[model samples]
Target chain A: MKFGIMVNEGPYTHQASDSAYNFVAAALEKGHEIYRIFFYHDGVNNGTRLTTPPQDDRNIVNRWSALAEKHEIDLVICVAAAQRRGIADADESKRNGKDADNIAPGFRISGLGQLLEASIQADRMVVFGD
Target chain B: MEEAGETKKIMYVNRKAPYGTIYALEALEVVLIGAAFEQDVYMMFLDDGVFQLKKEQDTKALGVKNFSPTYRALEMYDVEKIYVEKESMEVRGLTADDLIIPVEVKSNEEVTKMMTEMDVLLNF
Candidate 1:
């Protein structure tokens, strides 16, 4: 079965992104296809390349990038939400006249239409948030 | 991308107030975009979410954008299946007349039934 996922909270501050990653990894292990993982609200924070945690702690952003790279998952951050939270890609940064882009690899910024389309195309849509 | 003539019953469940957190406003953004897909979309307001539709909202004092006007424009976007929980309003001491738009005031049980009837359920 194909699964659509939405993560609605940022890392560290909430367990939502962590839980979503675990769920996606488990689903992949079970041989289920992940259609897309959409980042909305503070969840867009998970797609930034600027996060640097302690040496002992797990790197949440890099973990997602690796997972998406290995499985070729479509990691989408809602453009509106990302803009509001300052998570910008190269194109977004250029368009908005920002100094630099911060979007992590294996993730792309897009519109809410992507989320709606994922819900329609995927077998099930799962949301992880507060 | 969606196939031609393919549609899903998408429901946006709003259970938070408009301000304080960004869920309600962001949830509204999703609903507005979902309208373009030509799907069977429904917006259900319960708990403090029902407060999102109260009349005469003034966010000028709060220094935030007043988005209450968008609720009235929902019908223009062809999203008219609006519902408010009966118990949520009764306990909050609000009536249908107090809301800015017309909605189907359904009981909790009926709301649950309607939710089960949907193909996709999104909560905020």
Candidate 2:
């Protein structure tokens, strides 16, 4: 089955992000396809290429990026949420005449329309928040 | 071309006052994931959530880089149905022009219309 998952908590703030990642990873191991994964609010920090977690800990960003890359999944970052938190893609940075780009690989900076479209296309949309 | 058919719709209400919290981000994730599944998704900002739409959020000065910036990028995802309550904005001393992003600002009546139209409602 295909699934759409949203992770709103940052890895450092709560275990929700990690749990969502593990859930999706386990589902994939069981032969599930992730239709799309959305990072919002502080979760938007999940797409920052600038994150530097301790080496002893799991590199949540790397884990997420690798998972999406391995499965060729659609990793989406809410542009509004990300930008508010200082995560901007090259296109956005350039368009706004900003000096820096903060988008992480395997993730596309987008708007809520992508979320709307995902709901229409996927069978289930699960939200992991708080 | 209209659907002329019934489809499930979900509206996620984000009413938290940002800073010292993370609910706005969490609520937004639900909005996006739901949309990813191709479900009809809608979002509303009320109460302290009015701050979520405020512009000039440079949190870097406060050791953070203003989380409000991301809302501007929502258009590409097709999550265009963003809302803000007039009363909320007034209470916060905000005007549509003060927000960093362009959204369909409306009054309480308009907000209720959207809410009553939703098939499912989730608030955070």
Candidate 3:
């Protein structure tokens, strides 16, 4: 099955990110294809490169980035939501005159249209949030 | 149960009130955009979500744009399957008459059964 996952809350603040991660990992292990992973609202915070957790703690952002890299999954952060939360890519940073880009690896900033496309193409669209 | 090119049954479960947070408005935005896809869309008002359909909303005092009027425009998007939970309405001292648009008042059992038939379920 092809699955589209949507994360609507940031890490640490809610269990949504963790649950989505575990569900995706399990789905991949079973050889299912991930259509896309869309981050909206506070969920865009999961794509920031500035997060630095304690050495003993799990790095939520890095976990997502690594998983996305390994699986070659398209991790999309909503442009509107990302801008409001200050999650920017190189192009966005340059356009907005920001000093640097904070978008973590393996994640791309795009429009909500990507989300709608995912819903149409994927066999199932699952959302995790508050 | 979904096949390629098939129109999936998608349901947006609104469980929160409007204005207190952005969930209600954002969820509605998604619904509006999704109308273009021509899917079998359904909106369920559960818990405080029933408040979103309350009529005669005045947002001038709150200094926010009142989105209540947008509910009336949903019919234009071909999204007319709006369901309001009967228990949720009763608990809030509301009725179908209090809402801005016409909706089918469904009992909890009926709504729960309907949820099982959906291909995609989004809660806000």
Candidate 4:
């Protein structure tokens, strides 16, 4: 079945993000197709390339990046939320004249419309936040 | 008529003590994702949810800063229209004056009317 996952919680605090990650992995391992992952609000923090967990802690950002690289999943962040929080892609950073882009690869900036569209198209929209 | 394009309206209700548990924060997480999908998103807090509306929550002893500060920022994301049940406030020993932020306070009938209006209800 096709799945659309949504992550709303920030990585540093709650287990929502972690649960979402594990659920995505489990779906892929079960031979399911992950349509896309829509990050909004604080969930945008998970897509930040600048996120560096402590040496002893799990690096969630890098883990997401590697997962995307391996599975070719579409990881999208809400641009409105991202920019407000100072997380931008290369083009956004260049367009805004920021020092650097903190958005990770395989993840693009998207709007709520995309998430709406995915929810409409996918077989089941399985949300992972809260 | 409910059109095929019309998504289900799900309210991510938050009614819990903010510090002792992760329910309130978790509720916001759900709302964010629901908003990302542009679904008919709405959040309501009744009963203990009023505790979450309190502005200053110093959780330093637990090695955590006040995460309640983020609630104020939620409005900027177009997440306005948070509702509070007035009866829950009174029953829980809270008044409108005790709450930190401004919320749309409603009676039990009003809250029931709004909640029943939803097609899919998810509680956390």
Candidate 5:
């Protein structure tokens, strides 16, 4: 089955990110295709490449990036939410005339329409949040 | 109105109130977008979520935009299956008449059954 995941909270602050990560990993292990992972609200924080956690700590952003790279899944962050939270890609930074782009690898910034499309195309859309 | 694609049963569960957080408004935005998708969409108001449908919401004093009127527009978007939990309403002292839009009052058991049948469940 094709599964669409929606993460609504950032890492560390809430278990939403961890739960979504584990759910996706489990889904992949079960041989299901991930349609996409739409990050909205504080969930966009998961796409920032600037997070510098302790060497002993698990890097949530890198973990998502690695998983996306391995599975070739589309990791989408809502442009509206990302902008509000300062998570931007190279294109977005250039468009907005910002000095730097902090979007992590394997994640693309897009509109909420991607989320709607995922809901329509995927067999199930699972949302994780507070 | 024409259906955009294969129809899916989608439910938006509102468990929080409006104004205190952005969940209520953002969830409404998703519903509006779902309108264009032409899916079998349903909105359930339970717990503090019942407050979202309450009538005469005044946000002026709070200095925020009043989003209550947007609920009325859902009808135009073909999102007509709005359900309010009966027990939640009674507990909150809200009746169907207290809401801005007309809704089908349902018990928690009925709502849970409906949830089990949905293809997608979005909670806010």
Candidate 6:
């Protein structure tokens, strides 16, 4: 089945990101296709490349980026939510006159329409958040 | 990926109160954006979410946008299938007249049955 996943909370502060990662990994292992993974609300924080965890801890942002790279999944961070939380791509950074863009690799900034489109395209839509 | 112009039954489940957190407003934003796709959309206000439709909500003191009026504008966006859980409202001491817009007051069982018919359920 094609799945659309939504993450609505930030990493470390919540277990939502970890749970979603495990679910997606298991689903992919079972051969289910991922339509898209949309990051909204505080979940957009997962797309920032600036995160640095303890040496022993799991690096949440890199985990998502690596998974997307291996599976060729579209990892979309909601543009409105990302901007509000200061998670920007290089283009968005230039447009807003910011000095840097922190969006991690394998994630792209987009509109909420992508979420709606994913809902229509995917057979199932799963949301993980508080 | 699905082609354009194909419609699906989508439901937005709201369980949080407005102003206190961003869930209610976030759900509203998705509903408005989804309306443009011409899909069959439904909105359900249950638990503390029913407070979102309350009449005379003054957010000036809280310094937040009073979005209660936006409920009335939903009809213009062709999002008319709105439901309010009866038990939630009764327990909260609210009635249909207390809301800013018209909504079908449904029992939890009835709403559950409706939810099963939906293709997508987006909870906020």
List model 4 lDDT by residue over B1-124, tens digit each.
2124667666666767776765576566556655655456667887687788875677888885577777777776667777888888888888767766678898989988988887544454
Q: Over the stretch A16-130, how does candidate 3's per-residue lDDT look in tens digits?
A: 9999999999999999999999999899999998999899989999999999999999999999888888999999999989999999999999987777778878888999999
Instruction: Point out the higher-scoring one by lDDT: 2 or 5.
Output: 5
Stretches of model 3 off by over 4 angstroms after superposition: A94-99, B1-4
Q: Model 2, range B2-120, lDDT digits (tens) per residue? A: 23244677777888876667676656555545554544667788899888887777676567546676787677777777778888898889898988777677899999999888755
For candidate 1, what is the DockQ-based docking class? medium
DockQ of each: 0.73, 0.15, 0.38, 0.11, 0.52, 0.65
C-alpha RMSD for every candidate: 1.1, 8.3, 2.7, 7.2, 1.9, 1.5
Q: Write the per-residue lDDT of candidate 2 for residues A8-101, one digit (tens) a residue.
A: 7777778878888989989899998889997776788888888898889888888888988899989999887776778889999998889999
Global lDDT of each candidate = 0.94, 0.77, 0.92, 0.76, 0.92, 0.94
Q: Could you give candidate 1's per-residue lDDT for residues B23-56 as a string of tens digits?
A: 9999999988888888999999999999999999
TM-score of 2: 0.61
Give one digit per residue, the lDDT tens place, for model 5 in B58-101: 99889999999999999999999999999999999999999999
Q: Which segments of model 6 are wrong by more than 4 Å?
A: B1-3
Model 3 alpha-carbon miss at residue A92, Å: 2.9
By TM-score, the better pick of 2 and 5 is: 5
For candidate 2, the iRMS in Å is: 5.9
Q: Quick one: ranking by DockQ, best first?
A: 1, 6, 5, 3, 2, 4
lDDT of 1 by residue, A1-130 (tens): 9999999999999999999999999999999999999999999999988999998999999999999999999999999999999999999999999999999999999999899989999889999998
CAPRI-style class, candidate 2: incorrect
Q: What is the lDDT of residue A78 in candidate 4?
A: 78
